[model samples]
Target: MPLIEIKHEGLHKYRVIKGNDQYVVEQKARVQLQQWDEMWNKKQEAERKKIEREKAAIEKVQKKAMAEQQTQDAIDELEMIDNTLIYTLEIDDRIDWDSLKDLSDFKDPKPIAPNKPLYSSEPQKESYKPKYKLWDKILPSIKQKKIDESMKVYEEALDIWKNETEKINSKYEKEVDEFKERLKNWEEEKESFEREQKEKNDAIEKRKEQYLSGESESIIDYCDMVLSNSNYPDYFPQEFDIDYNSQNKTLIVEYILPDISDLPTLKGVKYIATKDEYKESYLSETVVKKMYDKLLYDITLRTIHELYEADAISAIDSIVFNGWVNTLNKATGKKQDICILSIQTNKEEFLEINLKLVDSKSCFKNFKGIGSSKLFSLTPIAPILKINREDSRFVDAYNVTGKVDEDTNLAAMDWQDFEHLIRELFEKEFNTSGGEVKITRASKDGGVDAVAFDPDPIRGGKIVIQAKRYTNVVGVSAVRDLYGTVMNEGATKGILVSTADFGPDAYNFAKDKPLTLLNGNNLLHLLHKHGHKAKIDLKEAKLIMKEK
Candidate 1:
């Protein structure tokens, strides 16, 4: 029977009223659902924020402790130097002036021990004599006594000077020995420190190189390798995608969820005490729906948990999970894959969740997930736009290197690579045009680069395509040649693509005809729109061409 709304309000009211004297069921159901939603919705926002705050605080504390430990290690190594040599310069008074200057200049020091103190004689002291200059000549005995006394005073002063000089020299030599020992130890420690730091830095650099060179395979490949050997429930298709955003240090996983039909409907078997027998009964639809919703939630959480746990490198700080399903579309009566839920969660945030006790649906809502209106509905789910990946492996064509001159740029991609890239591009484009694009043989194919076979009866036939890795702006001649090739081959259309922009005449010529001209920018945009990235510089390409 076709269902239709009653045209009259009175009739509709009557129909709902006696609609089995169960008119209150729908309204009561709505009230119950509303109560359940309210129970979770009005939760204090501060409670959710506490989780983030705690994680940040813990990370901050750990980092601070690590920095402190490094600082202490360095300080301990430096403290091994002689404290007095470091704190005082007492050796300055003992060093030879000549050698002292050289030592300060970082040159070899040949300090010589002195038998006497280093002093300059400014003037001789004059002594008061009792007019004895001539008297001493007349009196030989007095003159002899005066000479002996003068010798005695001189010897006494020399003895004192020698002792002081010896002591100073002895201390200078000791200080020199101590300084050398400390310097040797310090140099050794410094070298060790630098070597250790270099080793650490080299390890990090190796990892970085592996990351960029696709050797590490990023988290996506890592998880795939791990999960491929992982044990799981039977008939569970572990179809998923892993994309790492280097900028954000995040791993986005698009997991294909199983259909609700696969979920267990019976919660548990119960005993009928009255009859003393066990009753095997199926769960109510509402209970089954709740269990299924929770199962999906559990699966999402489990996936994130597995990735985080298996990742020893912790390359990904957080994961964005997109759980998708294939549901039948009423319009086309075909099953279409669509994402039913999306969640962005950090490791700390997810590990804190207790799946067994928490209301899975409410928790999913708290974590900000988008799903279908009803958990068990047959309606199709829309995918989250941000998590979608743009397949751009084709852009790698411009990055080809090796066996080519260093002066060459993007345009220097070997002719074979250029031809392959063009074939892939036109194949994608012509696929929409109802044609199969095939590249001609490398040697000679009647001056044709490629040909597209379109099966559509109207506006569909063989389309000739030519790829020009030109550094200079393509002139009208290339466009004219493509058109001639199309006509010669009895094709329906023609396209000429170049790495450089097309000249005005070239565009104008193709504008009025069945031929199409794709310049460098147009080609790039087409590649990017279809999830490819490429780099092209006309001036650089031109310079490289000139060099070649």
Candidate 2:
């Protein structure tokens, strides 16, 4: 007989002599293996279902227990209420008995008995009477005693009321203390329940881990076997060296590439190398220069975008500060200016670059000059400008006279001279139409400063003016006060002139509130409109509102 072997999906058999019996044995072994696999799967499924049913039963029991606890809490609250009502009733009963005692003392006939003997012998003689008649003297004393007794009774009633109130308060305090203690105990019990639940969950998790351990062990074995025979390169790059030549001040990087040729190249990988200078060790200038050059060359070799993606560049301006001269050339050079290239990325980016480099210098210089003392000196001053010649908006020219020293000479400003400049400017800008202008001092008595009433009959109306010389932020409160003054003075429109800039909040408050806020800048513009240069820039004032 020749050697023979028979193989099946689940079993194998070998025979030294060739025979058909080996094939039949292998087939029977395959059927037994299939049955074993089916039985193992069914056992695992039944175990999972049992665990789920047990968890549902535990949850249902917990819910029932919580419901019972709530019911018990309600019954306890009702008992507490009943005890409080009983205490109140007992206090009321004691008060009633005290009131009855006070009434009995008033109605008693014993005090009248001593007076009766004197009245019974009154007919005997006038000489027999006591020095003071008992009826007259004793009756007054008795009446006074009754009054005093009544007051004492009233005081006793008040005392009882106070005591009862205190007793009720004490009861409430005791109840509150008990409630707090109960709450603390309830919280502790709830925590204990939670801890027990967590322990149970942990136990279930441990059981699941044990149940899965065999399958996990088999899968790990299979994975190890597959990986050992798999065709893949496991080699990777380990280290790299950056070398700099001192003689020529040149930089060179020697990096080991991965042995796997299929991987892509890493272009912007950062390599940080440190060179320490100790007190005992001295480095030559040539070495220092070489190191500086190496740092610059490495930093400049890669663009900002590549360095950013690779996380190689730390601070955005690190290249600029480390290698100042090379970075400047690269930034401003015609052929390879990385700064301009960075700018070409976007318009907003270009603006930011310009602002950081050039415009910020002036602002920084200004800020540095404005130290602690001089920071607040730039107070805004708003000068009232008028519209024309013969304008009644200002104080009367003849009434606004001044004395020249002690001499008998009078100095005055005519309305024509004051109004001529304003009228000419208004004519050039607007039209030759004239307007009546009125100027008056603003009063705390609800009156405006300057009211410019148009001369045109069809459009003539009042324009209220309020000039504020403030060193702080003009708030909404001031605007509200001005609006009230305008409404009271019967003015249709209002103008608020301030020497300082309005805070954004103040500006928002004034919107559509029938008021126009003219700050230092606006005041200057108005002056310029009237053909007069503003003597001040009120916008530079140290206003109360500083941007956060």
* lDDT tens digits, residue span 1-548, model 1: 22222223322221221233344555655555555455545554555788778876676566555545645553443232112122222112211213212122223343433343354332222431223588798999998888777767666666766777777778777777777777776666665555544533453344344534543233455555444444444645566656677666787787777777665443334444345444444557786676566667766766666676666665778788888777677689987776778888877787687654565567778877777657667444554435533333222233222232324344656677777777777777778855666676664443577777665545665577888888888887787667656544445588888888888877766764678888778877776666666677777766766788
The per-candidate count of clashes, in order, stands at: 1, 7
Q: Please, what is the whole-model Cα lDDT of each candidate in the order they appear?
A: 0.60, 0.38
Which of the numbered candidates is closest to the native, going by highest lDDT?
1
Worst 10 residues of 2 by lDDT: 336-345
**What TM-score quantifies how close candidate 2 is to the native fold?**
0.22
lDDT of 2 by residue, 97-202 (tens): 1222212221222211112111111122333223445564768876666556666666666666667677766776776777677767666666555544453345
Q: Which ranges of candidate 2 are over 4 A from the true structure?
A: 1-394, 397-432, 442-446, 455-460, 537-548
TM-score of 1: 0.34
Predicted candidate 1, C-alpha RMSD:
36.2
